[model samples]
Target: MRRGDEFAAAIRRGNRAGRPTLVAHLQVREDVAEPPLVGFVVSRAVGGAVVRNRVKRRLRHLMRDRLHRLPRGSLLVVRANPPAASARSEHLAAELDVALDRLLRRRGPDHQARTDGRV
Candidate 1:
């Protein structure tokens, strides 16, 4: 997930859900091993270096606690929107939950998420 191509592949092939604070993209790959990989995207639109890092830190912490909720071998990219720079950690966590739920709901019980980027 550190590579640009990895993020691009997930963004291109994953299902996404957008919230006021952030947007999350999830791509499930059977080829990958257990322990899903995660990446973060905080653009200048959100804020300066200090603010962006703060947002990324908070998001990383939240995602760490929730990583087990995601399917194995999935690639998740959480992109912070402008509002996320000022949003509370709790608010961000809530938005992440809602977004993940919406994304997961699109997949059937088989845990194979859709890649069409819809819903």
Candidate 2:
């Protein structure tokens, strides 16, 4: 959701705080002081413009749905692979869930406590 220079900087940092996956490459940074934002990178290597846009659209939707599970005040960059350019919505959704859970796990025991309503 971040735009302009700030978004570009986050991608350049490329310090993936969470686990990376085959469906997407995630880079999470907590250096920012603002609310959490997300960026998508679907290169030409993945497909034509239409396909790339489609991938971005799907990723955005998945991110919106999973935002609450993510940590606050961080930046997440989701880079799409070539296969993801044409992936179906259901398949992409499943992959997004897996990648998101992996990333969320990096937040450690705090999240577990939150899940159990003990935090």
Candidate 3:
């Protein structure tokens, strides 16, 4: 989706769950009725435009490969730390996988707990 205020706001409000490779903060709410989609935030602080673009491209590719594996109806905002800015595509992909794995695992248990309680 196009970058907009709502998307940025959701990123700001999202929960902060981190992995050693990457730290992610996501806010999942029903007001957003769509399935899992992601927005990335990389600022000038990360590096020049070229570096930022490279990081974005790498993450986008990783996301394309992993989106189907993700839980539906979630909005994910991935923020890259300084170390990630200069990372190679493979390293970026691996780090993203680690971050996503952590998030999905956390979500799964919480969802199961809630569902089991409701049953």
Candidate 4:
């Protein structure tokens, strides 16, 4: 999560879900022993420095409480869209939930197996 290579790897290998305000990439790794690692990508395309930071902060706060809901060792990267700079926190959170749900559903059997402690 701290390295650009990690972000690139996740974006390259993970499932993706897109919203008007955000895009999410998710990958499941069996090797991690700690909690899920989450990263935010807010490029200048999203806004200026201040706006990007604000969007990143909002995304981080929204993702914090929801981290435990992801499978252990998962890697998640959330990239903010231009509209995200003006989106409200609640709206962002809702979009995040929807995006994550879509991504997880796409890996239905694997997700179910993990939750059932079978994977």
Strongest candidate by lDDT: 1
User: Candidate 4 lDDT, tens digit per residue, 72-93?
Assistant: 7778999999999989888999
TM-score of 4: 0.89
Order of the predicted models by TM-score, top scorer first:
1, 4, 3, 2
The better candidate by lDDT, 1 or 4, is 1
Candidate 2 wrong stretches, greater than 4 Å: 1-33, 111-119
Taking the tens digit of each residue's C-alpha lDDT, what string does model 2 give over 1-119? 65766566656654443223223334445444445677887788888988888778888887787766555555667777777866787877777777766666766764544422121
What lDDT score is found at residue 94 in candidate 3?
79
lDDT values for all models: 0.85, 0.63, 0.66, 0.84
Screening candidate 2 with a backbone cut-off below 3 angstroms (N, C-alpha, C), the clashing residue pairs are 1-38
Error of 2 at 85 (Å): 1.5
Please report how far candidate 2 places residue 61 from its true position, in Å: 1.4
Q: Which parts of model 3 have CA positions greater than 4 angstroms off?
A: 3-5, 19-21, 30-33, 110-119
Model 4 has how many clashing residue pairs? Answer: 0
* Lowest summed lDDT window (length 10), candidate 2: 17-26
lDDT of residue 57 for candidate 4: 85
Selected candidate, larger lDDT, 2 vs 4? 4
What TM-score, over all chains together, does every model reach?
0.90, 0.72, 0.74, 0.89
The residue ranges of model 1 lying beyond 4 angstroms of the native Cα positions read 112-119
Residue 68, model 4: Cα distance from true site in angstroms? 0.8
